[model samples]
Target: MRRFYAILVAAGLVYMLFMFLGTIVPYGKADVADRVSAHFLAKDVNSISPTKWVEGDKQVPHSERVYGRKGFEDGSANVVTSIVVNYRSFDTLGEVTVLFASAVGVGLILGGTRRMKYGRKPNFILRVSTGILLPLIILFGIYIFVHGHLTPGGGFPGGTIIAAAVLLLYLSNEEFSLNMIVSKSLEGSMGSLYVIFGLIGLAAGGAFLFNFLPNGVVGSLFSAGVVPLVYMTIGLKVGSELSGVVAEIHEEREG
Candidate 1:
């Protein structure tokens, strides 16, 4: 019986090795960088021309219009930013929902068994320092999300900053427990509201995630109709999810 089990394990390992080698055996002697450059150069420059797409669509694909070029059009100056907050805003909303779900899963797996608290209480020096730094971190996060349409930062980066602040709070304040109910509830509510708003846009404008509000003058604070709003929702959802994950990990470790 022992020999049979060993033989089976060896056979499985051999099979996996063959499968791994098979994937690499078919590669041709081609320069990967050259292939990438060729693909990049072959693209229709006129269609993806930054100036044309960002300034105003003379002739560009609808996918690019809705999901690619909002940065230039809205003066955000970052293509990825425009994509997340404006063009593919609905996808971002979905991503937040996935984050929320992951947080819940982590909580259920780790938080259910027992609740334990660890780490030392913060000394006076640490407490004072955190109190000073917390507000600044939060302010910077807000700035990043708000300027997403006109600058380099956006929801994900900003949300991460806010999450860091929450972690600091957990570390510095030993007695305080993260309010899981409030955090998860807020995440769910905001994520749902984001989707509902997108659906409303679809119903009214005949396009999902359509910028129902006036496009406004390009490059201005109020310009990218729904971009900032979507970004704010994303930031909130991301912050909550990340904080929840951290809390779950802390609980697991304590247990």
Candidate 2:
């Protein structure tokens, strides 16, 4: 009965979504860009005083007027970053929830207390190579998430990269293990921090995950206000979650 109700609720939501979409007038190719997207590209969704968008105007292109525009409302240089982490950040939160759910499901199914194992013992070369490359990989992951607002990479990809480093360690050294205390602690804390930041936004600006912090000059490391901090928490959470998954899989494989 609960499953049936869930299906019913999901079906109703889909119907409502389609109905909402049907009501939206298609802003044609030549029409003044959708105000939401226009503002996103302009990096001024948080603008105290926003100018309304007009026809034949900015759509996807970053105008020189907005390029490196100081005192930006969003302060994120990457347009997609502005959209993903700034404009529709709630969607990004939903994405984090989805990944968390997957990790939980995997843990429930593959949970184990045994040691992680591989098919055969790796040689010294593999172990030494992993040792040499591990720091570099983790460093690159940090770079990716740290520069997320300025570049193409973000928390998800960056965290995955960090988890890849953990995977490398497991493959090269069968006895090597991640400290569960630290891993679980980091994962739980980071996830909680992500939501706490959202709650702070709610308290400060009447919106969850609001960019309440002041926008610094565009194209700078500290420019995107609370965005970089948010990404750092996400990267840590995702890294720990995925590392947990890798541990589970490896432990179950040879257990």
Candidate 3:
């Protein structure tokens, strides 16, 4: 029976290899730009035109109406930012919830409840080094999250900082144990709140995560309506999930 199984597996592998080769054998390159141009100039080009719905000689506000004013009204200078945080904030909420669930799953699989055998007793030098670096790391994380709109950093970076601080605590103090319940609670609550906030937008207005607040000055710190809010939720959720993972890993190592 074992020999028969081995033969079957070998045959399956050969069959898969043949199928894979067949896909690559007929590899052909097509002119992408030509295809795009053909589509654009097709007989059904009217479907792609933006001015179809506008009636009469009314000047279509393509720049001002669709993006500029609408985007600024929502408080984000970046149209993409406005769309994600305001128009599609529910997706972000769901993403964070998925992360939270993944963290919980990891903790459960790794036996998070198991206590460590050896307490984390860092030497004086290590303790002092961590103490000094902790604040700096935290500050950097905050800087990333706060300036997410203007620059590259964002909630993910900030949350990573918070998790790093917790890690430092775990490393410096042997008796230090993360409050899994608290962390999990916070994660779940924030995730729920994020979704609820988007739902509220739908209830009050017609859109989910619609920017109801005033669209402050474009370049100002408070410009983006729901960008800050959504980013904050992301940071909180990521921090909690990362910390939980760290705690689980620590417990596993100790066990």
Candidate 4:
């Protein structure tokens, strides 16, 4: 009976996937083949832009303005970064808030000290290697979040990386402890700063999360105004929250 239900679910999922693909991909393969060939043979990749069949209310197809005017609006070369941090910043804030709240809830639920005894101690090599790698890993995380506007990775992934580093430390040294107050303070400060930035945009006679900061030179380290700052803030908040969660869980498990 279970197997039959599982098969039914799998078939439904496969049918849904096929329907999705059918909607996206037209029945005709000749056009697709021609386009693929043209794309491969095109002299300038920019000239071979993808066609958007969808039209707006004005019967005009929206074009890729990000690539065309990279520096004018937002100085982020990376469209994903610009969209995530600048265009949909308020949404990102909500996402971070949700993550923070979840972490806090879990930490609260699992908050306790119950030390589980393990006979074996961490080896000298593991301890020394973790100590050596910790700072470097943290630096890498900072770099990822800081350069999110120009690169692929952003605050969330970078923060997870930093949290992973903390987890490594916790695993290596049982005596290692996270300062809950400090972590909470940092998290609160970052989240507040995000809101303050939004308010600043509102005060400036623009909508919330308006790009009020001067769009500096494109592709530079300090180009994307408020983007890097926001990402860093998110990184710090996420890192702190996740590290605290880890500490709470670890303590509960081994208190």
On lDDT, the candidate that comes out on top is 2
The residue-by-residue lDDT of candidate 2 on 1-255, one tens digit each, is: 978855754664465456557556665644464455665544543344345433355433234335434333447877677778877888998999999899989888887787755567798898989989999999999999989898899899999999999999888988877887788889988876877787677557655677888777777898788889989998999999999888877765332
Model 3 poorest 10 in a row by lDDT = 38-47
lDDT score, candidate 4: 0.72
lDDT of 1: 0.67
Superposition error at 57 for model 1 (Å): 13
> Over the stretch 71-167, how does candidate 1's per-residue lDDT look in tens digits?
2234344556666666566577677767777777887787743334665557778778999999999999888988887788888888889889988
Tens-digit lDDT string for candidate 4 (103-127): 8799779887764334579778889
Off by over 4 Å in 4: 1-73, 113-119, 253-255
List TM-score per model, in order. Answer: 0.67, 0.75, 0.66, 0.71
True-structure lDDT of candidate 3: 0.64
lDDT of 2 at 159: 97
* Candidate order by decreasing lDDT: 2, 4, 1, 3
Provide the clash count, candidate 1. 2
Output the number of the TM-score-best candidate. Answer: 2
Candidate 2: regions farther than 4 A off:
1-34, 41-73, 253-255
Native-to-model Cα distance after best TM-score fit, residue 244 in candidate 2, in Å: 0.5
Tell me how far the alpha carbon of residue 244 in candidate 4 is from the true structure, in angstroms, after superposition: 0.7
